[model samples]
Target: MDLGIDRQALVPVVQQIISAVAQWIRNSGASPGTRLPSIRQVALDNLLSQSSVIEAFERMVAQGLLVSKHGSGFVVAQPSVLHEGQWYEGAEREWGAFVDNPMGELKLGCGWLPDAWRESDDISYAIREVTRTDTAGLFNYSTPLGLLALREQLLKRLSQIHIATHLDRILTTAGASHAQDLLIRTLLKAGDCVVVETPGYGNLYRQLAFHGVQLLQVPRTQGGPDLSALEALLQRHRPKCLFINSLYHNPTGTSLNRTVAERLLELAHRENFLIIEEDVFGDLQHASCTRLSALPHDDRVIYVASFSKTLSSALRVGFLSASTVIIAQLASLKTLTGFGTSRFAEAVVTTLLANGTYRKWVQRLRKRLRTQMAATLQVLEDEEWEVFAKPAGGMFLWARPGVGDRSRVQACARRLGVLLSPGALFSPTGEPSDWLRINVAYAADQRALALFRAMGPARSTSTILKTTSV
Candidate 1:
């Protein structure tokens, strides 16, 4: 086959063989089922060891580039086509679509921070330390309530935020989404009514819909949810639960005020509905913020938070705090659903938290996000875009062009290879709107700047002021 083997190169011999064989298959016009030279023959022809040849072939087979048949040697495999509908097929997708963007495409609407913003030294060190010190974490499943040490760390964090709770009331899950799913499975049933924000998290809307729950959406205002609208919905339908983002809301970056928090609690008590407060981005805020779970309630509030937003997403560490009764129920469901979260990941997070690495890391992250957010907001203002609210701290800014049509804005973004999170995706009904969720971390990129600048100047100063007053 004349596979090129470079002995002096830094690449290992087995990897080199794998690359050469793949290149040969592509360039030689080899069709499916075409067999290459025997492993022994290739080893002899290339002046290499048979072990290297066998390892390369096995690796190739595992990669779906080749298939091994019983006593027939390896043959080229058919090219695999990923089914479009297998996953991320609908408009409800947010993160999946962001992740699937083409290389070099600017992700201006992504949920998390850019790669350059992530500080990996502490996380990497924690991973290595866990690998060296905790053998049981590597092999065993976490307990029903998750690792005790990790939960203890979480308890300290909760205390900092003033949500006093004991270890029995805390339960760790894969992430906030997993925690939400456990709550849904344990507390809700099909045909139940749940109140959600109108322009809120798309993934949560989809999750609720998947469980056959009817969603009653209340409009989210600059202060918080429109209390009048929420109260009106409560009058007609008796919802079982109300899901809300208490701090740094997903798309708008709005934090709940103390007045709103208290009122929401009162309504929850009167209406006999549970409130699930999601605080995934709460850590990024520098000032103290009101949390629904922190307020006095009759065990009607469940708080879910995760390290995925500020920390490494791959770590998949998150926890929920609630009444001991609710925690016990959710923990049992968590065991049945996924057994438990990764003990290794929990251990790594514990190490980071115990050594104070996580606190210092988030402090730096908060400062960076604050600076980027100011710069991005300035750019938006110069380009005459209308911002929904000027966030105190966090990564998102909800804004739209002040002059151009929605279609023109989208077309310009496409031409500049900029991915945007259109307002429609945030709606529970998939209803279209002009606003877009701009992630400040990527908004400073040249491509995103160009797209925003292409919208031209605002039509009128009065119009711009009226739209952006919130």
Candidate 2:
């Protein structure tokens, strides 16, 4: 109730009061559940009208920093601004929810590749083939360096992806996610600064934040990252690593062109930081032009990709190709962490590769994805949604909700049993946005159309008005 405001400045009286009260609660060592001052009492103490105090409290509640009880007035809801600082623990909670009842609900929330898109069939055939040929190796634990044959296959694929790596430079993990985790554990220390793209993949964001690495963000551009902003950040922070999704960048679906790729590589070289390229969606691109890759046979690039989107996410076959120095460190880290990827799965992947079925599977899946992407795009375009249509390849369509409150859009999607990923989840502060990241690989069903209908108006009038005024 002791909150005070200065009327001399341009800032409104209510905002000053709100900030003062918020800071007081923060500094007072009060628990999150501690009740805040009553609106009337706050108004009286600050010599402000009751309406102003009420509006201030309402704004705080809307921001999720405060919670109001029907009988008790407002209380601090989230006392700590830990969304950015401790995102991994939060991500763990979210994943826990996913696992709790995965198929029970229409889980459009997480960007999971459809079950039919997985390599279960290909994997099954490989397993059978491997069992028929050699059952002994399948049952045993893989070498710390991974199966030699699987490593060879991985190296060959890396060469096709513009990274010329030897078996010695490739290491296997349980999944691409595992590779990323191991890399962070091996190379980065707590509090090390890591730069990621704004509106980036939340899992990576969570993992980096969870490990206590300071995250710096550069805005995503039409073709790649905002280079000027990235350079400015490079000048200011000099981060330890730069994590990028160069080919079909996540959430935004913007691929890096050759020019953008060269600039990014140049920055990484000058900054003395490694580039962690997560190209999980590289195989899904339908375009004839090959997407750009950070691995230019450079030791500074740690290339990582998975079968998560291309094949079966459950197959958990992810490879890392880097310089001998990093590959050695990451291998050691993998040994200490999960030992190695599944031996049976590696044997299966090897068998499939040897048989040439893996390529056929990718061709079929890519064709289907291209068709689905078109259908998805048609539906969205029919709805007048704004998206980057030139994304050469990827499952997702990065879109802005055009003037609508993203939270409202999310809520509407939920009500229609079609969940969407709100753009705020991609930001450091979980700030609200008009953008939404959507996975188009999932068949565009009537349910999805219904969900869009729930969005009410297409453009947010307020947002358009604000822009006009600006």
Candidate 3:
């Protein structure tokens, strides 16, 4: 029970207690089901408050290190055998674009922001406020449409982007993935043709394939999907839907220009196909950035967005806006599959939005990401890397060395303790590629720079391709 709590250390008392207990259990070879000292006894032995002991115990239980027995107190739980490498075993790794990087490795290709960059104050306040004020949020399931307050806030947000929608057309989801799943289930049948970008979101490709849909990949140009190729596909195949990332497209970091957006809508209307616009990174762009859903023909576009990229990923709150009919269908499917999204998480997001904390935080995030993007681009230029496109604003920067084997580049990344997202994983068919999806947030790290530096400079002018622009 002697945890040797360092009261003067910078780490919190609760965290220290949790670490000490975990280490003790590991070193002493505590078996599963072994009961631990009571909270009162631990507090007394360590000269700490019972609240601190209880919090530490609760955190450990949440981490699966301990199990809280109703009357018997906390006991050790079975140790996990899954290591970080196992998370990316085979196909899982290719589709797991948002998975956390292994400990001590630079997540140069990861989706979310680094832990240090996240603002904890507003989020922490929201969590505390929700827990204190909303009792039902903590215990009950959300309504079919979602928490009313959160939906209202989302509606306001949509209006700012010029996307007009009512509360009945908004449906909360676990995340953008969940929204996509519901849409796929509600609108698509097996063997239906769906148009996806060649270098698109890998997870979406996997999901559509799993649903037994026929994938028709259209080449993605800097401005957006190649209109000529897309038009050709529409003529050749009667696709049921076209999935697209309108703003800050994943991997490529490109946005759809107004001209392309108009053309896409026209095609959707002509081809009799739905357009599922994934705007998860829309908030990170300037307010004036073009969106398909913001256009007058929005009925054909089902808009899906989430706060996971800018806000905390742990807070899996997302929403989709569509025609009332589509929303009703999705809501029913959501209720049947998962009951509903998290009411508590929705409440927390609502609190942040209502108090204007989320708006200010996103503004700050956009500024920081812009700065990082510039720095990372400068470094890539200095290293003579071929950038796919210089995004106006977003977390991703797709680039590759002017000359090198893709396998060698990956091996170099591993040697430098950096994790990278290979471009092949972004392809619909999983074709071999030399391109890489670099996260601007992590590309500035010295470890990431080391990997770039190792690749050396572009060999010749002929080797470098023309940089695409929006």
Between the candidate structures 2 and 3, which one is better when assessed by TM-score? 3
The deviation in Å at residue 290 for candidate 3 is: 0.8
Tens-place lDDT digits, model 3, residues 41-107: 9999989999999988997786667899999999998744111122113236333323632235677
Model 1 agreement with the true structure over 1-470: per-residue lDDT tens digits: 65656564333567667656765675566878988889889998888899999998997786667899889899997633111121222353336447764335678888998888888888899999999999999999999999999999999999988898999999998899999999888889899999999689988988888999999999888778999999999999999999999888989998899999899999999999999999999999898788988889879999999999899889999999999989989988888888989999999999999999999999998998899999988988888889999998999999988776665565456545666788877888777689999999898788888767766484354543332221
Candidate 2 lDDT = 0.70
List candidate 1 stretches off by more than 4 Å. Answer: 1-88, 92-94, 458-470
Residue pairs in candidate 1 whose N, alpha carbon or C atoms collide under 3 angstroms: none
Itemize residue pairs with steric clashes in candidate 3.
Answer: none
Candidate 2 residues lying further than 4 Å off, grouped into runs, are 1-90, 97-104, 288-297, 456-470
- Cα lDDT tens digits for candidate 2, 349-381: 788877888888888877876777777777666
Local error of candidate 3 at 448, Å? 0.7
Ranking of models by TM-score: 1, 3, 2
